[model samples]
Target chain A: MANPAYVAVDWGTSSFRLWLIGKDDSILGESRSNEGMTTAAKTGFAEVLASHLAKVNAPENLPVIICGMAGAKQGWIEAGYIDVPASLSSILAGAVAVPGQRRDVRILPGLAQRDQARPDVMRGEETQLLGALGPGSTGSQAVCMPGTHSKWVHVADGRVTAFSSFMTGELFDAISKHTILSHAVAGADQSPADEAAFESAIKAAYEQPAMATNLFFTARSGQLLHGLTAAAAQAKISGTLIGLEIAGAMTNAGSGVSITLVAAGRLQGLYEAAFKALSLSHNTIDADTAVRGGLAAAAKAIWPN
Target chain B: MANPAYVAVDWGTSSFRLWLIGKDDSILGESRSNEGMTTAAKTGFAEVLASHLAKVNAPENLPVIICGMAGAKQGWIEAGYIDVPASLSSILAGAVAVPGQRRDVRILPGLAQRDQARPDVMRGEETQLLGALGPGSTGSQAVCMPGTHSKWVHVADGRVTAFSSFMTGELFDAISKHTILSHAVAGADQSPADEAAFESAIKAAYEQPAMATNLFFTARSGQLLHGLTAAAAQAKISGTLIGLEIAGAMTNAGSGVSITLVAAGRLQGLYEAAFKALSLSHNTIDADTAVRGGLAAAAKAIWPN
Candidate 1:
């Protein structure tokens, strides 16, 4: 096993992942848990970190760099925000130290778009953008980091000029569980996803973005009229949200700006399919890699090995 | 009070409203309760109807004409649907009777748009449409009936050409109660609604319907960045949904179709403000009056005096 030099953590609202890095910039050990900021707030952030560190057998003196909601006002410590238009590298300079820690623990700041009409914020995704695009990247790009609150950041000359956060993922969860559509999507998790239904919905919503909510109603109506499967119903919902998001995000970016989808697992496949359905050319980046790389950047910047 | 001719009930999923009509076509008595189809299903629809009838002091042998979810499959009787493109009078013709009742009890059938790509169904709003635009109307009109599932019906030459249902109200409720925006709108019901914030949101969403979900997030981000009040957050949510609905509904109608807003109370005010904000000319109709008018039309058709 390599000697640990620093720890990188992505502490989100409901998820926590940490990587112990060797001095050679290689991973020595890793730990993950559901003990994110929301849980750690009640159980003690220090205690949660200590347990994870022990699990990975990290050294006592090794410094730690964290990003995401842990730096939020309600999280471990408020690291604040870097307002756009901001250079990706500016995030490192705004990192706030968590006080009263034996091992130097720092949390990275989020990014905020202060436009009165379109006020938006992102905690973890700024780091993801930083990692995905790197510093001093050229050309205009629309970087999509899809999650509970999907973020579309417009980067021009390595500077985030503007961004919008769409409530696509969270809205899906709420609509599926709390609305009449719940009945339509019941038993969907047990069945295989209806890819055809998903793709169709993607095109429908993308072409008619104004009919997004109306499209959502089709999930139930589709079932009632056409005997649509639960999986198909769920697919329709997922597709409508993703398609509407793409439509909105694309509108925010300049004409012919390349899209870089930052996602992993299920979300990545869904978005890729959606992009393909709309005939929008795009590239993909693993979300986990991006976040970890972002954390690594912050770690190297802070530790200065 | 005038002699009770018939009972008119708008029995929905979560609400029940009753109006006793006189022989001279006037409302002789009225009754309302939270005992809609859901409650009536468990407590006995017959009993619930009987209770409301008793409260209204209806005659023992007075017949009943019911609309809304009471006619749904899960309601008192399966009144079924009158598939479109349908005539306004077709709904009254499709009414299904509840068997074994001493007096005639008929539940009006709903309207179903069976388009494979955009399948839709409306339980009670068809009656609202029938009343808002009488059976012998002229020209094209887009009738907006805002509620849990806002219905937009296209009426052409006294015929129901097409319609779409936007899950505006239900989405607003689910997003506010089950999502992160819940925190933003906490205590909003206790505060006076922020009219300015609502109007601004209406304009924003109307101009950029693709950014509907993004606008929803502004409720929280707006509060976090601009110190927006709970009332403002609530207003933003309401406005975004209504605005998105209007945009989608308008798109479904033909050019220069006059907008008839059939709504009452708070929803009516929100939508009127939304229309005014967008500078869209529209006429308002009392929803209660429309439903009753539709029911009266149905009664005359069923048991002509």
Candidate 2:
């Protein structure tokens, strides 16, 4: 028999990322591509994988542990999800077995909270969240993972009990770029006036949650009455959206549990502002690290003696 | 006021429509453009107006009636909605008297459904619906106005008291192009297959009201197992959204009130299917007639005793 190698994959809507891990759990190489689960079909998935692996010097025959939307119905292979009180070991154990090239390939199941208001679902991220907390992670913790559909995951005693996904980024884009409000929001030209407007907009969203609809008017009224530049008004609009997101998500977390934000780049700055607005204590972690760390923890679980 | 010529403009999110109507209620000429309210503000309102009027052989100082989003907060000028129990005459009376245009301009105020969920607001379309009802429009009636944010309005005694906005069209687009459900749908194309898929989807939404989220999975399953094409699936997705919309908005109409569908072109067909699922009787009015009808009604109100 050939020596077994470890592979970790985070496949999402817009991109595919893979990591080749050694026997001792060190990442030998990692790769990513724009060919997300949505764009790539079953046949195209192979090419995307090969293209990504070629960049990172990874062997094709390595055993792979997959997570995220890759296993979704549209994904390469539909890796379904498990339910609440989900254990890291239980999920790793329930891995949907998929055929691979001379390697034991497995897809991690996502988690669904059917009892919630929206019956929210999480795929690759839940496993990554689990992997971040490690094999024996216990107690109540709130994890904020922000993106187009930002998720607030509640992990209780090494199990994911519930989570909610907010369409913050998508809503912001639609309302800003697609609706009448788009008239007020200018693009990413660096301006001091724009930054201040953005901050003020955020403040508005946080202050009067019910008044979101009303505040949108101020974007133009601000320009009309007070001579707010379009860019500045745009920022105010952006702030209102992010602020509402923070206010809405924070209610569930309460002030009790510890909060960890799993984000990267631009989203990190927004999360920092949101957390501060809600008066919640928070620690930040890189998006990739959480995924890698979560995968490492999952590795410990399936291999735990 | 040399010869006092008149005009009517219907402005929306994506398109601008204008009709040169005489005082005796005759359409002398009409004009349209992709230059909607959102785009024109950047280049100044007067420039866009002149550009549109350039197509018409009318004098610059013609009296103009404007509607739709052009009167929105971010629009050309902020026009307030006249509350319910208020006649079209009352609303025309409340129209923001923007002093001296390149023409004499009167922006028809939109309608406001107060103290409800999100404080519902409608502009140009409401007046269009009123126009469709005609100058002699009296008593109770329901109108289905379809677009990105489709609105179902119920009018009693010539006043709009209750109406609901459904993001059905936008939801269809979002689920088709953005959500995990994207794989379930293909782009819009062709007709026969669209009809079959759409009918089935409307039925599904009608039958299972609570299982909207669950039902989406069938898009992929239907395609994979039942050989549903991407375009067919797309049509079904649209059908489901509109069906859900009808189910929600048509609850109060029952058999008591008359249903007037104020849609033009492609949407009237979709609205028909939506009604079919609910087994409801309705009348369809096309865009041009509806616009002309609406304009004539508004013109009456502007010159009302």
Candidate 3:
């Protein structure tokens, strides 16, 4: 068995994942839990980390490298942010040390675009960008990271030129549960997936993004008038939001810019479908691999052999 | 006091308003309560109406004309809908009577655009359109009725050509109370209103409607980086949603289409500000006057002297 060298942790707002990296760069052990920053803030970040470390039988003196919300102002310690346009390598340099710990611990700083007009910030996704594009990546690209707050970062010659966050996923959840559309999508979970409805919505929204809220209303109206199924209604909503987001993201990206999607599971599928429906070609990178790779890059940078 | 001729009630999803109409069509007495369709649905709609009528000292034999959600499927009775392209007079002709009532009680039918691609329905706003544009009105006009589900109807020669429903007001409520923007907008009600921020957001969203969700995120980013006040944050959200709605509403309207705003109080002010910021010329009509006008028309048609 390869000897465990260091621990790589990705602690987000509501989730925690730890990987015990071997000396040869293999994952010797792993742990995951819902005790993310929100939960750890109440239960104690140190205790949470210690328990996860123990679960993986991490060596007491083993160094730990972390990324994501754990380094936020309300996290274990404020790692701060490296304002862009900045080189990906700058994130490694901006890592802040967690004080008074027996073992060395460092959390990677996030990226902030402080444009007065288009101010934006990102945390864990910075590390994912680091892994997805690497520190020395070149050429212009639009990198999309789909989630609760989907992010589209425009990179030029390995530097983040600008990025925008779309409240697509969160809006979907809120609109579905809190709006009248809830009834239109009540039994969606149990119904068959409606790919055609989703594609149609994506095209409609992409073509006429201004009509987004009106298009959302059609979910209920369609059900009332056209007997639109619950699944179709749900699909329409997901597609509309995704389509609106893509339109917004593409506004800043120069024509013919390469598109790379970083996502996994359901989000991965949905975004891919959206891109296809819009006739846009794109590449995909497994989100887990990208984030883990990012944590690894940070780990190696902090503790050079 | 002039003899009471009839009663006009605008019973919405969450509100109830009754006005005693005199023989001269003046408002002789008025009563208002939160006993709208939802509340009255559980607590006997007839009893609720009787109490409000008693408060206004309504005569037992005096007829009543109602509009809005009281005509919905879940309300007192199913008043159904009048499908458009329709004449405004058809709404008056389509009033459904409540059986077994001692006094005449008629609930006006709503308007439904049963387009396969963009199906839409409006319960109360149809009446507002009728009152705003009148039965014999001519020329093309875009009638904007701002509310929880704002309806923008395109009227030509006293006929309802088509309409779109934007979930602006409801979305504003949900997003403000249910999303991350909630934190950004906390204490906004107590803070001084920010007209500059509101106008700026209106212009931004109106110009680039695709960037709406991104603009919404600026509420938080602005506060984090620029120290934007809670009121400004709240204003930004409101402006973005309203701007998006206007942009969408204007799409179906002809280039020279006259804009008529039917709203009252705060909504009127906000929409007026939005229109002014967009440099669009529009005439305003009081919402109360419009619905009452619609109900009066219905009453006159149903019970002639």
Best by lDDT: 3
User: Which consecutive 10 residues in model 3 chain A have the weakest lDDT in total?
Assistant: A184-193
Q: Any residue pairs clashing in model 3, and if so which? A: none
Cα lDDT of model 3 by residue, A1-305, tens digit: 89988999999999999999999989999999999999999999999999999999999999999999999888999998899999988888999999999999999999888998899988999999999999999999999999888899998888988899999989999999999999999978722299999999999998898899999999999998899999999998998999999988887785588999999988998999889988899999999899988888888888988
Error of 3 at B53 (Å): 0.5
lDDT per residue, candidate 2, B1-305, as tens digits?
Answer: 22324777887766888877765666777788888876886776667777777787767667677777778787888887776645655665667756656556777778765542124567777677766775456878888888877777887776666766665665556566665446556454633256776777777655543333334544544554456678776776677667666655655465667898988767877788678766788888776677666655665566553
> Any runs in candidate 1 off by more than 4 Å, and if so which?
A190-192, B190-192
Q: lDDT scores for all predictions?
A: 0.90, 0.67, 0.92
Which prediction has the highest DockQ against the true structure?
3
Question: Candidate 1: deviation at residue B102, Å?
Answer: 0.8
Candidate 1 docking category? high
**Ranked by DockQ, top first:** 3, 1, 2
Least accurate stretch of 10 residues (summed lDDT) in model 1 chain A? A186-195
DockQ of 2: 0.07
Interface RMSD of every candidate? 0.7, 9.0, 0.6
Q: Per-residue lDDT tens digits of candidate 1, residues B1-305?
A: 67889999999999999999999988888999999999999999999999989998899899999999998888898999999999998988998989999999999999999999999999999998888888888988888999889999988898999999999889988988999999999988832279998898888887888899999999899998999889999989888888888888877785478999999988888888888888889999999999999999999999997
